[model samples]
Target chain A: MVYSISIFVSETQSAMKFGGKIGIVGAGALGAFYGARLYRAGNDVHFLVRTGFELIREHGYEIRSCDGDFTIKPPVYSAPEDLGKCDLILVGLKAFANHFLPEVLGPLATPNTVVVTLQNGLGNEETIAEALVKCGVHRSVAEASKQIIGGTAFLCSNRVAPNVIIHSAHGFVRLAEFQGSPKERTFAVAQLFLDAGISCEVRESLAAIRWEKLVWNIPFNGLGVAAHQADTAVILADPELRTTAVEIMKEVIAAAKVNGVDLDERLVADLIGKTEIMGHYKSSMQIDFEAGRPLEVEAILGEPVRRAQQKGFSAPRMHMLYALVRRMDQLRQSNLENSQSRSS
Target chain B: MVYSISIFVSETQSAMKFGGKIGIVGAGALGAFYGARLYRAGNDVHFLVRTGFELIREHGYEIRSCDGDFTIKPPVYSAPEDLGKCDLILVGLKAFANHFLPEVLGPLATPNTVVVTLQNGLGNEETIAEALVKCGVHRSVAEASKQIIGGTAFLCSNRVAPNVIIHSAHGFVRLAEFQGSPKERTFAVAQLFLDAGISCEVRESLAAIRWEKLVWNIPFNGLGVAAHQADTAVILADPELRTTAVEIMKEVIAAAKVNGVDLDERLVADLIGKTEIMGHYKSSMQIDFEAGRPLEVEAILGEPVRRAQQKGFSAPRMHMLYALVRRMDQLRQSNLENSQSRSS
Candidate 1:
């Protein structure tokens, strides 16, 4: 597993620096944005898109923002098999898509291929790390046991268009050793991202950053969704809710600190402020609410609070807000069910 | 003010038994229940009602519960002046109406009338007591209020039909003297209620009961409104939330203890359980939520928390919950205004 990961890492570094074939799996906002940027910088970028977004080639993606608009025609494919192996594969999607990712990424797994994940939240590394352990397999086992390279992508924001992702904001995208030591190839991959005008940080401590981001995401997103508000500002505008948000953030920080991140108040506050300035960024929470989707309540709100308690952190505010949001979500679900039953 | 209250007490005692007219202000649920029980037991009853409840006069007030329905008719007056002087007045309405209660109960007051309040939540006694002091009115206030009076009309559930109050669930009513001594007249009043089939308890320490009730109330009612859930059970159903509720109650109870009323944990739990059993009963907070009215957030959630904090009782749960519900109320108001503006 380690040998394969290193081989993949070397290829990523080579491809990123030398500007070779780069595949972006899950070409949604983050994927599309980074892919567009790399393509704009004169690198060959390919997108593995789902059926719904396959028409991106027909209608160009447009990113509406205060910043200047830029669009690009990165090659798009439905599956990795359609494009064969690439030097580096970037995975950008929601955490829930882990089950399908390995299969979707199968064709990109040459001996010298590396998968970089830019997905948010915790556990992506473990998923990818485990998949790499099962990399080589017989055809019968390959159907279920073939492993995929794990990658992490971190983007500021992307456009929601067909052909182009209007890159509005830029942030450092860190791809670390998902489960092994960073090789010379990893450093090259980081430099390649820089050469492509994408700020890339090769992290020795990727898990810490991922967990830190997750900590803030859970509270703010859950709060935004529960209140049916836009973002942190909508919640923070009220002093009490603001306090609650801070409290929740503190709990998250504590969880990370317990998990060995040692994030202080200042860093958490800065991250929170950054999130707010992403300006009208609706959290996945608000997105779910608007879509009437069953919220990621348990994972986003319950799990952290539960962990915090287990770690002996008195996360009073998180507990209260989590309960409040969970109950609200439950009510929303039951209300919908009632409405459906009545309509039926 | 003290002199007047004493004079009213003397007059009520002089009038004796079922002779003097009893005025029931805000003859909605509590008034209807209490008034009907008294009227049924042969006391002359008069009700002060607002517009739109004329139907109450014809069908009488009905209290429907598993226990059976009981109804009684007494004269109903829309305006305060329409009713003559009464020996006793029962103020049974929402706490928000306490501010304007003086206007409603003014005409019904004689020099020797005792005003018994059966309203829910904190500060009702203080409001009535302050009003009596300010107006230099002769009206005795009770520190403890009774849910039992409404219960005893055996009309656990009541619908006012015409001039009568129909009660369904007959239960015991608890009453106690204010901080001062329990006068002979207070006991006499208790006897009158008992004679009317309402089981009554005379509490030597009304403050403790009130504080105990307040501790239990802050968590359930505040959480119910903030969480937008129905009952105390919803708060308790989630173990984390229940622990939070208990923590909040402990703080409030500690504050109350500081204020001279020590409430044990068992009592708080019992009160919470009772509120749970009163299923589908929207708290004053929920009622305010539905009615688009300003909540008694201060009295119900804030004051206790504030007092607790002042008393060095760390009620983080209560404080946080208070802030959330207050914000929710404000946002709801803003939403109302925005919608109204759009409509206009």
Candidate 2:
């Protein structure tokens, strides 16, 4: 099994010299933004869209970027069966929609397919691995895990309308293999993004990068919504909230340390200082909340908190935020259901 | 000075046997309900009205209570000067409106006036005392504190309209002297509520009762607003939120203990159990948030958290709640001001 996995990883790495067939599983703001770039870079990229399938199929995808504008008329699929097998599958779905992974990836993933999840928070890679196993794409969790790569996309983009993505700033991505250190396939995937003009890097520790990203996400994203739809600037403007954001960051750093991922204490200050110049960036969670969409509470907060707690570390602020945001999401879901039922 | 206060306390106690001139400052829902009862009981009660001055004066005040309905055409004063001096002043103002305290109570309070603040959260008595000093009704903070009594009204009431109060249930009040142990003046004020056929009790330790009430308010009221306008039942219904509520209660209890008020740890369970039966009780803060009115964030949350922190104890959940709610209040206020200016 190890020999076959190593062989497949090397083959994937060598194949990265050419623009291999790639599948964009989510095709939302993040998916479409990155996927469009890849298609423009001459990859045979296919998008599996749900809501904007017809709009995207008819009008294609338009990227109104701060870096540069681009358009892609790639093939779009509404279902996994039509997406076809690909050498690389990039999952950019919101963590909340992750439950649909098994069905979505059932036909799209193959034994040699390298799956990269650039979703927020923890557990997306694990979910993808499980989905691969469940969908019979891989024989076991171990086999699936080797083919899975976890990524943190530090991108600021928004899908204002169907088939139209506005890329505001920062499209850097960090990639790492789920099972071990950055493998040959991980570098290959990073190369794909790098070739597409994205600032890409490969990390030895997936947990380290995920925790580092969470050091920013858990506080800013959580507080952005939890603080009554406050943006980054609004949070930084209030001294108490700024202190709270720092406290939350410290808690995340501590949680990361307990989980064997040593994050620098200065990362808190660094992230805050960087965010200070971001000029009122409404976090993705906050945006979802304002749009009355489901938040990635479990993935961004719940999973991290649970992971830390399993190792006997108490993150009171994170726990409080997770509970509050989870409740808010649950309330939003129920409210949406009620309104839908009333209208129907 | 001590002898004079002792003499005044006794005189105040004796004067409680008669109606005596009573001033009801901040005649909102709580003030209107209790003031109407005092008026109905034949006390010389005068209400200091603001927004509802004309409505209350023309139609009188109506109390639709679960206990019983009552109406009173007591004299209503739009300004404090018109309210005149009083033997006892019952303050029911929202803690946010406390800045107007010195101005509002300036003419209504005399050196002989016994002030009882039936407001939520900590620092109300201290605020009252400060207002008395600021208004020149008292020579010093010590004198003001001696005359000020703190009370927590466990009332389920709402002012549905101007001069119309709907009392759902629970009108019991717990009173204590702000300066020392419950003196004659404390019992005298308790008697005033008891005379109006309300459940009222006087306690020895002012801090003890105040902290005890906070054991409920800090969690239910804070979460009631912070958890996206969730009520008591909604908090108890979700297990995570229910757990968060308990954690907040524990923090409050610990805070109280460090501050020299050892609340029984079982108060956590007791309060949660009681809240389970409250049947969707919207806390005063939640109600205020829903109405887009100014929240008593500083009084209910900010002060208690600061008090605990001063004692070198950390209440992470309370601090987070305080920051979130305070930010929400600030955001709401700014939005309101913008709309008002735009309209103007």
DockQ of each: 0.44, 0.68
Winning model by TM-score: 2
Worst 10 residues of 1 chain B by lDDT: B146-155
Worst 10 residues of 1 chain A by lDDT: A1-10
Off by over 4 Å in 2: A1-19, A54-59, B1-19
User: By TM-score, how accurate is candidate 2?
Assistant: 0.92
DockQ of 1: 0.44
Q: What digit string (tens of lDDT, one per residue) describes model 1 on residues A15-89?
A: 535456888877767777767667777878887778545667666455543346665655777766887788777
List of chain A TM-scores, every candidate: 0.76, 0.94
Top lDDT prediction, candidate number = 2
Candidate 2 chain B: worst 10 consecutive residues by lDDT? Answer: B1-10
Cα lDDT of model 2 overall?
0.86
